[model samples]
Target: MKKKSLLVYGLSAMCLSFALPGPVAAVSNESCMECHSDDSLERDASTGHLASLFVDIEKFNASVHNFDEESCVGCHNAIEELDWDSDVPHPVDMPNPDCAECHDETVPAWAGSVHAEADITCYDCHNYHAPVQLAGRQTVAMMREAVWGKCHDAGASHDWLPQKEVHFRTGQCTVCHAPEDGSHVIFRLYDVTENRFLSCNEIMTGLQISGSFMANFDTDGDGVISPAEFQDFGEKLRERRFTTDIRAELN
Candidate 1:
């Protein structure tokens, strides 16, 4: 019985080679390192393709998705072409992988948060396909969302940082917050906090970008965590009292 099972497994592996290629060819990411071990392609675009290159593959492969799957692309439909310059043939209007595909309950949970009801779609967090882990969360979002989402168009429902809603309706929180790279995504506000966008910190903090928050609140020109600012920072993080005062505050 053992020999027969081995034969079946071998056949399955052989078949996996076609649907998958490179380190993605074998379930072992070491195989990927054997080829992509080089870092030349690491910083190609504002989009980070090399961030997860050093991740612990054992942990990834041990997950239920790796049992018979030979490649990660089977999951992240984006970048399947292996080219960042080329337009991704990603099918959906929102190419992000839906958590509901595997964990149906994920959507409803986030919907209850300040992001969803305001229509901050899944792409704001999970990113297109790069799954992430933040504050114990397995989010697929970009590294920048940590701060941008706070004063986003969604109002003060959720804040990775803190500021005010003075320009919340204008959908312009990037004036102060800036992503590390020229372009990286973060959640930000929109139509009365009922809608949002995933954009780069650079776009939000354009060279000519100016706002009252800077002159009124920023004691330091550094543009981040100015002490004079963020009085209701709690509101920016959805960490506020949520008291009856909140009903008045939202108004």
Candidate 2:
């Protein structure tokens, strides 16, 4: 049985290798890295743009999409010929990777977003070569900052909001602006009594005071504590007004 299991595992691994896209399935990343790894391989275009053809293998290996099973050509499949140990002219009009093929699920949502309406693509927020997967508050903050800078300038665009800075800082823009029926409502850290958002330090301190509170509020064990849960949590905080200082948003 053990020998049969081992044989099955080996076959599965071999099939996975064969299933990988592009010539990278056969050619290793080192084949392309020989020339691209050279920082000196730079060119000046007729349009006066200085194009650098260097690729830092160290950073590429550490990227979020980096896997031991794939090579550079896996994403850059347009390169039909490999000129090893010879200087080949870099294609200035080379096409970007077919990210939509792999990210079909997320592509639609992204295409519908306000950023997409303004002609922003995935590469704008997500670095292709060094993509970092962000989550939770960090992701919210990053997106907020990016959108604000690119389009919604507080002084020029959002000057009409009452307490604009406070409103922007207290909660994510999506909390109030995002289509209510579009996505799930995400509960955020707030201070009901103060009518302001709780700082990271305040949240951490509250957790230290009572670690079991989150588990109690999140009855379904889902990451989100729903509006009903928020009301319950608020009431509890109000009841223990002097003792507890943390609360979640109701809307």
Give the alpha-carbon lDDT of every model: 0.43, 0.63
State every prediction's TM-score relative to the real structure: 0.26, 0.49
Q: Estimate, for each residue in 1-251, the C-alpha lDDT of model 1 and write its tens digit.
A: 99999999999999998777565322334434443445442323336444432434555555445554535554444533333343532222334455566667767666676677788777555433224334422121223354345443443343553343433432333333323213323333322343333133422243223455455345566766433354433243344222211111110
Q: Which model scores highest in lDDT?
A: 2
Per residue, candidate 2 scores C-alpha lDDT tens digits across 1-251 of 99999999999999998897644234467767767899988778556988777877777787766754445666777765565535563344667786787789888877888878988787656656656544554323465654335644554566766556655555565665674534333445555556777664565455445456567678788867677887777676555553434433424
Residue 189 lDDT in candidate 1:
32
Report the Cα lDDT for candidate 1.
Answer: 0.43
Q: Following a full C-alpha superposition, what root-mean-square deviation does model 2 have from the true structure?
A: 13.9
Against the true structure, what is every candidate's RMSD? Answer: 19.7, 13.9
